[model samples]
Target: MENPPGTIGPGWLIKVSSRTARPDPGACPTHLRTAVRPLVAAEPPVPFRRAPREDFAPGPLFAALDLWEQGGWSIGRVLDELRSTRGAFRGRNAPAHPSLMAWTVQAFERYVAARHEEQAAARAAGLPPTVPVRLGWTARTKKKDAPDARGGQQYEHTAWGRQYASADGSVRDLWIPSLGRAKADRAAAEKAAIAHVMANGAPTPHRRRGDTPPEDATASTRLPERVRVFDFGCADGSVTPLLDWHRTEVQNRFMADAAPAFVSAATGAGTRPGASCVDCKAISGCAALHRTPRLWGAASAAPMRGRRSVSAWDLRLHGECPAQYHLVRQLHLNDLSAENDGARRGRAVDAWLNQRHADRPVRGCRDLPIPDASSLPAAHPLEGPLAHVAVRMLTEHRVLCPLNGIGSNEQVLVQHRVTAYVPELDVVVLAVPDLLYTRRGDWIWRETKTASRPVWEGRSLLRSYPQLALAVLLFSAGALDADPRRSWVELEHLREGRGESRLERIDPSQPAVVAEAREVIADLAQPLLDDASYEPTTGRHCHGCQARTWCKPGTAYVAEHPQGVGRHPDAAEADHFADRGSIHA
Candidate 1:
């Protein structure tokens, strides 16, 4: 029997994947502990249920790749075989989208082209032909002085990617696949891969500890002279060599730098409930998580509706274009384009405020030093005119800080994930306010936004910022465990210069405000809930759409309007790729 949660047995191992080991400035440390640590029980463990996806799952794509490479089947034949295998490409209990077939074909062709290019380049360089191989590296070490119940720790770094080697196994290549454009690997993850590649010997078939080793297992453990990461793009079927390291370069690096981080990931504590909460097994005992029920006022979904998460951003994206929502948000296909200036400035301002709000002793921004273009904090780097504008905005925020008059004992949460579940809708509604602090006993939800221009006088505030509408609804529904009469929502609009920022407060206690908030949210959300096809609608927003490369209508729209005339300056700041609600508000 395995030990209970937080107690490691003798068989327990502290293993970390490249994905889990990489630096995520926003990641919850407790999440890392739950993922890599070995204290989980074998019996009915903490149940974590994820929403069923209607988008493409990569299992079938890779499986098809295997059939094409190992079984010597043609691409068409592999896809046909894949289609015949029902439930193979699906997610959870949901069926795969029909568009995935086209995506798979494009991805497979790209893979083949990448391989051909690799072989050609090798031949040109007078290198021998290489063949694909099933190779994995697991670098394990036993720590002398362990922390928990276990006497020692087995620290493991596993390499996950497609592998290829020369006939003599002297040269090897690791191909990493991405559904969209290939991007650079995280520094820590790249280093971990190097450590794994250098520490392990020749590849062998995986088996149980007591199982006999295969006769063909190579004993000649020779380190390759060269290691390269070939990043394959499934969206456009392009392959880019992301990283190439010589053996000397790998040997020169210190292996000890990664050790402390590995141990810390296993032993780290604290909870941050956001996107990770949806799949967290330790959520039951997490005190940091604040749950609010029936916050969205969504009607009861039909029987057998798979649980899903909803956020203000989701409704915003769906309203912009449903196809963009499905392709960018659900499918997660991006062209790796740079964000526009307004969005970047807003993000910088958000970060700066969050940092100030998160300071110890629960102080306000009233006394903080204003930053200039050169003196801005290293974490929130802005440039050119926007940097100056951000500085002025930061100055304006001093008076509007929620902690200014609040009692010392009052709670202050900045950029904290606020989650609520609508039982009727089978949906989890998420919101992350710029600042959430308490005065007396009432909760104050503040949303800060930076804009080149001021809020249009004609538009309703609720329609201008839908998040406030959601906030009003949540607080009015008693989501924060406080009296609605005392609690209210705030929108702080910061523009360049002193005394120009406007702070608008909405009383959620008022029936008129509550009704308007409901209508604002429902008008945007109802169409999304009813959407089944997610058809593309052509507009100027398509020009800035990240997934437009794969969307025909969006592509056509962008092509016709190459000048990018009608794209909203603020829309560029919207976060289309955030797994949960972003601090972009």
Candidate 2:
């Protein structure tokens, strides 16, 4: 069936409400009805670059709220229905709240009078039939006992119920309560209710159906020259008056001089006191705010923060800086471009190794199958050097590593992904060992890195090797044995054999092992765990960070100290900077 012209569709009934808090250093609400923002951004998520929308669902409270605002029903009939029927998904309905019920009654009476005046105008103008006011709604009731202890009963709507205006649809006896929760519902409630309540002592006409006249058929329904708004707090009963649409225009013009400005709390970029600061997700580690809000108490800190899985890379990136971690690892806003030669070389080398090992294990690099370099890519410029480096690393490992030879009965895994939940830490640990195998009955988990500096060159390998520590934690946890190979974690530096291809056997029995690993995880997660404050640490590492272009500190530092053709990182380091958290979350 076609909808009548001017008849409001259910979809267009309620505007999408968001947490639009008032910008401070602006005009305060003279009457609260003028407020447009909500208390929170709990707007239903929508696709990026799309307008926010909320599906209209009309049950009891929804129907009651809408119908009263639109002048489709009187509160008396609604209350009777409310007594008999139960509402679905009931929350904040305020069934026994006198303020809610009174407001509903007063608003409904005002809406009916204003609507009737419009009908009268159409009749006087001899225009075509103007659509009469109708309510769009749905209703439901309790079918059975609710699963939970509280019996969930609802006043289910049964049919398309409606009420019409009297012949003389003029101003009505409307009163805006000086006090109560009488503020406007930003989306659904119309201004007609405010129009009536603001009018002083307008004669409220009793409602009637289209065909029948009211008990008192002689009510006036003339349109008023102006409408007003009011505010009512639950605590105080005084109704504070607000300006009508006409008055609001002036405030809009005044405020237009300076638009409200908002800055990311994480950046500590704003000076104006914002009402939303309390709920701002980026408030943690805010230098301007100088506060760090934590989620759980010290008692639940470890378990709560570690509940969600994080990778070895996640721990490492966070260890560097929480702000960088938030950008590269957490939000993934700074996906590094693969245009660098080093990145291409790393990919080519990785692809070659995986293909070579996945086919059949070759103990010697000379026996390893080499792929045609032309088939790789035009973008991969370091193909020759990358190939040579791979061969050197493979040969060195074959000669020095105990796992160079293995029998068919021996267990071995290549390029295998390992994930294990650390019970003590209460966080999932993920690591992909390039070579995991048994050598003379010794189990080892090894990682290969083609970096400028090898693992063995570092002064304190343990201090320099947080990722290795995580690898050991995952390896030992995945072993299923109380302790495997006394928890061995190795780092294979594939930088032309400048450093020793060494392995560090960690003792899981040592309290420090678990303590240190947990500390690393906590350090990486604490900022995010606390309040998602990813503040920039402002350090030297910011130089080549691809994401630094978008970071606050990086941008600030660059703005302050502009330099010559600065550092251009070689291609090989590109893959190292990419914060690909482990395979699993």
The global C-alpha lDDT for each of the candidates, from Candidate 1 onward, is: 0.66, 0.39
Per-residue alpha-carbon lDDT of candidate 1 for residues 454-516, written as tens digits (9 for 90 to 100): 888999899888898988887887667768899989988888866778999999999988888
Q: How much is the lDDT of residue 581 in candidate 2?
A: 31
Q: Which residues of candidate 2, in runs, are more than 4 Å off?
A: 1-309, 335-343, 361-366, 369-403, 422-426, 454-458, 475-482, 497-528, 559-585
RMSD of 2: 22.7
Q: Model 1, residue 236: displacement in angstroms?
A: 7.9
Q: How does model 1 score by TM-score? A: 0.73
